[model samples]
Each structure stands twice: as structure tokens, then as C-alpha cells.
Target: MTRQALVPTTHERGITTLTLDSPANRNALSVSLVEELGRALERYGKDPSVRAVVLTHTGNTFCAGADLKAPAGPYAFVALLRQIAELPKPVLGRVDGHARAGGLGLLGVCDMAFATLSSDFAFSEVRIGVAPALISLPLLPRLDPRAASRYFLTGEVFAGTRAQEIGLLTEAAPDVDVALAPVLEALRRASPQGLAEAKRLLTAGMRDAFDRDAEDLVQRSAALFASAEAREGVTAHLERRDPAWLQ
Candidate 1:
């Protein structure tokens, strides 16, 4: 299927690129976009010619999280994120700009991820009175629990260096293309079977971690979603103002 939300290009060397095309809203994660992304990823995963996948976004921002105006329900967003995480191929996130909330969740799910030196990341959900339910599952394993709690709770933006230091990003390069080149080259050099095996093994190793706390996380998220504070927070953000909770 021809993708409406993104452009998928495959190279002879077996690396597939999925470029986020919805630049108008800073490539916000609309339901359509997430569906398109999931479909494209599923296609690439089934194609033997595709050895690895690279995810990038257009315009100035990598992703600004979910579009407030879009009608993407919470379950849809969470399902799409889970699909990305469960893809068998080695997925690489090439971030050139800002990635926040759900956007940060995308970066966290990738098998390997890199960002531009100028790229910024934040788990700004708490400020909106929502829990980083899906994001925290993948992120907490890669980051220090204390540090993750601090940032997720405070909703503060951090630079790429800090992101790398905290284990959210693997490397910070001068630019997205530069950061991606090495990963692509490495993928090309590695055995596809080996790569897939390693990915499966690592994911299996992390299953216990996820299972242990997934229930509590889901409950926390559900409670946050039902709270008056969350409604007020999302409303205030859509109105481009401070939330009542902040006051």
C-alpha cells in the first residue's frame, strides 16, 4: 500500500527508510500517521530485501508527540507504540529535532537510536497530569529509575547530551544523516540472521522486567486518564496556556 503519512524508501544495500512526512504539525503522531507507520513497518519486516529500518522525520522537529487536535484515542497510540517495539528487525531512530512525550516513547522503543547534537528530548506528560505509561516501560530499563522519575514527573526538557548521559539516546551527532550513516553501514556489515537473533534475545531478556511492572503502570495510566487533572491539563495545553494543576 502507498503510505499517506510517510515515504518509504529502500536501498540496494537492504536498509529501508521511513520518513515522517506530516511536517505541518511538526510530524505529530496522529492516528492515521501511527497506522501508516505500523503498516509500513510490518511490510518492511516481511520483506527479505529489507535488512534494517531507519526512522526519521521531516521539517525542523522529529516528533512533537500526539496532535492535540487529532482524535487518536489512548489505546490506539499505545498499540502503535507496542507494534514498533515488537518489530523483529533492528529499528534505528534517527532524530534531528525535538522529541517529547509520545515522541520520546518512539525513540525509546527503537532497538538502537541516535540524535543530532541539537535535538532535544523530554518526557513532559506529568505536567499534563498524564502518566508516561507506554514510554516508561521501555525507557525505565534504559534509564536510571530515579532520573526517569525526576524528569517524567517534572516534565522538563533536556538536551541531547543529557539524554545520552541518561541512556535515553545512544549517541548525539552533528546531524541526523551523519548519525545514521554509521548505523546503516554497521547494519550492512552485520549478518541479518545474527541481527535478528540478537534483537530477539535482548527483547526476551527484557520481558521479565516489563511483565513485573506492566500492571501497575497500566493502572497508573488509567487512573491518570480518568482524573480531572488530566482533562484540565490537556485542555490548557490545547488552549496554549498553563494548566490549572500548575497553579
Candidate 2:
């Protein structure tokens, strides 16, 4: 049997682009998809010809976060976030679509991110009886504390402009590609060593924190996902009903 492919890669002019190709579920982070994304990053990240990597999705939505129905989930997803954060080559995000829950977690790891103003985001985990525990690695550092508190508890969907204002995004464009191109081109012209060293300098403290706290966060996340509250909330969501916790 053929393994279904999730990350398909292309390389040209010192840039490698990995497209998250699963559209059926809005490119959700299934186990295999996370694994494939890790493998793809390792593959291109080590190539001498590659100076940078671009992560983009092929669907209307970038990612829906974890596949709640998967018996085991969002564990390997944490490792994937670490991989993206540590890639010696710069990783730029091309988000032309909405990113939700853990999806925003992955976006937070991008060294630079460009999203379309049309795209919306939410920390929907709270609404479903869990918290964005593991994702807070890359997330909390980039976000304004007041903004983070408001959004984390409310789970409200915010526009790209608001996201940028709160430090979740570097820039928002009317057209995603238009915002992404010049950045990629500028990265392509940069000295590989310069980019690598700068990225390392820029993210050292962040990565140190991720390494220090990731295991604990992952444990917290798994516990939450396995809880009665999460199970009820997720089931209610799938069934299109209000969860019991809601008034």
C-alpha cells in the first residue's frame, strides 16, 4: 500500500518550498502529516543548494490544528514545531489562509511570516475545553501578554491586522503572495551564513525556552486532550451542539 503523501516539496534558486498538500480536512495536523513535514524539512534544510524554506498550504485554510479524532495526536506535532524552529536555514511562512488552534502554533515558529488580511485566526482550544499548552512555546514569546490573555481565554477569531498588531504576524497583505515574494527574494540574496547566524542569534533564548519547557507542555497537552472535559467538548463540536460547560 502506498503511504499517502502530505508534504510535497519543490526547490529552485536556493529556496525550497514545502506545500502542506492535504485539503480534505483543511490541511489538519494528522500524525502522518506532522511526520512528513519533519522529514521534508530535514531533507531540504541540509541541502547545500537551499538557502531558505517556504512553508505554504495548498487549500483555502492553512491548517485546522490537531485532528481531534486521532487516537494519539499533537504529541509528534510538538516535535515538528521544534524542528521548524531549529532548522539552520530560515523558514518563512506563506499563509494565505486561516490558521486555527495548533495551526497558529506552527505559524508562530516561522522565522518570518506573511499572511493575507483575509485570513482569520483563533485560539479555539479554549472553546473546546483545553488550552493552547504546547503551542505556547513559540506563541507566548511573540505575543503581547495582554493580547494573549484576552485571546487565549476568549477564543475569538481575530483578523490578520489584529494578529500583526499583537506580534503574531510580521505583516499582512491584501494578497499573500505579494507580501511573501520580496521577503523570499531578499532572503535568497542574503549570505547563507549571515541568515543562519542572525536567525540563531534572534531565536536563541526562544529555542532555549522551547527545549526547557517542551516536554512539560507536551505532557500537559496530552493530559488535556485525554480529559473528560476535552472529550465532551470535542464531541459536542463534532456533533454541532453546545458543550455542557457553556451556559
Candidate 3:
């Protein structure tokens, strides 16, 4: 059987849309998906006609987190996040479904994000015995400390409005496309050089955080994922039973 394209591309006017097409696993970040997404971003990043890149997905779950069965390496995921942050053109996110665990990292990396009010989000790494280490590179600088603390530690789900209130989303309305229309128009109207400079100023701190802490966090993430506790947690999750610690 032929392999299907995991990340598909579409362009309209000056905007490029990259859809996460692996709905079979709720669009989890697998190695192939990450690679394809990086390539797409690189291609659009260099295209002057592509004023902005929109990252969206094709399922009820925008991204269910790391693909447990075939998760991408920590370094690769970090690189993908960095690419979004460093892209010359603005990267926008349109989320109309659920985002959990590492998936939330995508929203944080976007220059701006819009979601439907009914969409939900969560930072679920804790339940699986790992910290949200790599994702914090983009999220920590943007998220409200108090809100981050609550969700990060508790692993609770929050609606798009709460996500927006905590800085994870730019806007959450009844319709994501409606919310994004004006922003897309503004992006199309803005000068390319102007947008690049503005994005540089906006994302400098995040890029610095990546440089300062990404390696250490990657090591930390690898260590955690390899631990006995994490193994048990993951196994239990897959088995649909409570982890040992909860007993």
C-alpha cells in the first residue's frame, strides 16, 4: 500500500495552510509528521508570496500529544518549535478541537492563534510521569504563571476562553475562521519586512529561552521518559488502568 501524506499543504493568496493530516492517531507528533511539517515550514518560510503560515488540523482532536507508539525524539520536537518561532513570516494557528500535552506547545509557538470557543486544551504530561519540559520553551514566556502552575501541576483541561485568558490563545470565538479573518487581512496588508522585524522583537525572548535551556530540558525530558515510573505510567495509560501511584 502507498503511504499517505501526513502533512498536506494548501495556499490561498498570500497565506499558506499546513494541515496536520494524521488523524488516525489524533495527529500525534510522529517522526515522519514532524519531518514533513518542518520541511513545509522551511519551504513556506522562504517564499515571499506566502505572507503567513497557518497551522491547523483535520480531526476532533487537534493533537492528542506525542505519539506514544512512535514519538519523535525530543531534539526533533524542539527543532520544530524553534522553526515556528524563528520563521521570517508570521505563523498563525487555527484550532477548532482539543489540544493536549505536547500539542499545546504548537499553540505557544504560533505568533498568534485562534480557536473556537468550544475547543479544549490541557497540559497532560504530568499524568504520564513526565514534565512539560521542551514545551515550556515557548509556553513559559507567554503563559500566565498562576494559570500555568494550576494546569501544569494538575493536568486539568481548560476551555479555549481560559486558554486565551492565560495567554495560550490570542482569541477564542464561536468560529475560529471568523476570528482569524481580520488578522489574516492585516497580515496580508502588512509589509513583509515590517512583519519580520515585528515578529523578531516579539519572539526574541522565546528564542533566547530555547538557546539557554533547550538542551538541558531535552536531557531532562529523555531522562524522565526513560524512567521506571514513566514507563509504568505510560503502560498503564495504554492499558486503560490507573497508574500504580494512584493505587
Candidate 4:
């Protein structure tokens, strides 16, 4: 609980890898971790020599979503996701394990995501009586509408291959680095100005749109999480039982 939440490593190849390091909580997006991640990315944004960012995790879970016990507002997280999406350089998500809820939103913001074939994902907010409102900013843009609707409502787990099928990941390979290497190399080959401009072309105005809508979405998330039903759902989940509505 009192250690570094994110670890940054730079390689000679102009890649900076940010590992979600709080494995004790399965890399939950606590306030401190989220803040640290934002800071790292912001620093990377200012470096012209950094060609790409690799977002990976250190444990069996890529990310288990937000730490429910961490009493913080969604504003920071909303801003963090926006920052990643708008970073001039490409961000590659390398998922070797499971990710849930807010974690899957991170994948949605990636320029490309490479995942191990066995990884799993879910938009699990609805199950906890909260809407995936803030996550929807990035997620809705990339996800197949039908798939998003089904998974968002049902909170069912899906395989990495299925995630790729629905556009959450660019590739689902048996080996994570193997699939990611060529992509990184390709990014490396591109001129920094070219990558930044091309990224602008690919994502023009999306950041502005997120900025415009984020406050309302965060408010919705906060209201739902603070609701009576959400309290019941959280209790039932922790107790390993169905909520009263389900029973």
C-alpha cells in the first residue's frame, strides 16, 4: 500500500515502459497509482526522444480496475485516460494477464494493444451497480457496438481473442512481446514529427470531445457508486452472494 505504484523503464530503442507495479492489489487503479501513471505519461509527452510507450503490468492481473476502498473522485482518472489518448506518441498496451472495468478502458485508448491469447477482460461496473460512464469515452469509440452493449450490461468475461475481434486489442498472440516487437519497431522507424502529426490526424478532436463530456460522465459514475443498490451489490460481491435484486 505504501510503495511505488508505477515503475518506469526506458530503453535505448526510445521506448519507455510503464509497468503497473502494485501487484499486491492486482494493480488496482488507486488514486496514488493513477496519479503516478499520469505523471509518467506527462513526462514522456515532453520528451522528444521517446518514440513510444508500453503499458504493461507486473503481476497475473493486468489491472483489476479501480480500488473500491480508495475514496477519490473520478476526475483524476478521467483526466488521466484523456491524457493517454491524446499523447502525441503511440502507446502500446501489452496485456499478458487479466484486466477488468477501468483497466479495459486503458486498452481502448491504446494505439495498438498486444495481448497473450489467454488474457481476459470485462467491463464490470454494471455488476457493481455503477455505469461504465467515464470508461465509455475511450471504450465506445473502439469497441464493436453490439459487443460493447452485451458485455457492458452483462459483465461477462471475454477472452483475448474476443477482445481483439471487437477491437479492444490489435492482436492476441500466444507470446506478448513477439507480437509487440514488430509494432514497436515500426513505430521506431517513423519520424517523431510524423508519428505525432499522424496521431493527430488519426485522433483529431477526440480529446476535445472527451474533455467536453468527461465531467458529466464522472458525475454519473459517482452518483451510481454512491447509490443504495451499489452498496448492496458491493456487499454481496464481497460476501460472495447474490444481491437482493438478483435473489
lDDT of each residue in 22-126, candidate 2, tens digit only: 898788888778878999998887887889998889988888888776522656887788888888899988888789998899889899888999889999999
- Model 2 regions more than 4 Å off: 1-4, 71-74
Cα lDDT tens digits for candidate 1, 3-22: 45355455658898889888
Runs of candidate 3 exceeding 4 Å displacement:
none
lDDT ranking from best to worst? 3, 2, 4, 1
On the 0 to 100 scale, the lDDT of residue 219 in model 3 is 99
Assess the local accuracy of residue 132 in candidate 4 as a C-alpha lDDT between 0 and 100: 83
TM-score for each candidate, following the candidate numbering: 0.90, 0.96, 0.98, 0.95
Global CA lDDT of candidate 4, please? 0.86
lDDT of candidate model 3 versus the reference = 0.94
Worst 10 residues of 3 by lDDT: 2-11
Model 1: colliding residue pairs: none
| Among all candidates shown, the one with the greatest lDDT | 3
Number of residue pairs clashing in candidate 3, backbone atoms closer than 3 angstroms, sequence gap of 3 or more or interchain: 0
Ranking by TM-score: 3, 2, 4, 1
Q: Give the lDDT of residue 136 in candidate 1.
A: 73
lDDT of 4 at 179: 93
Tell me the tens digit of each residue's lDDT in model 3 across 126-224: 998998999999999899999999999999999999999999999999989988998999899988999999999999999999999999999999999
Candidate 1 vs candidate 2: which has greater lDDT?
A: 2
For residue 97, model 2's alpha carbon misses the true position, in angstroms, by 1.9
**Model 4 weakest lDDT span, ten residues long:** 3-12
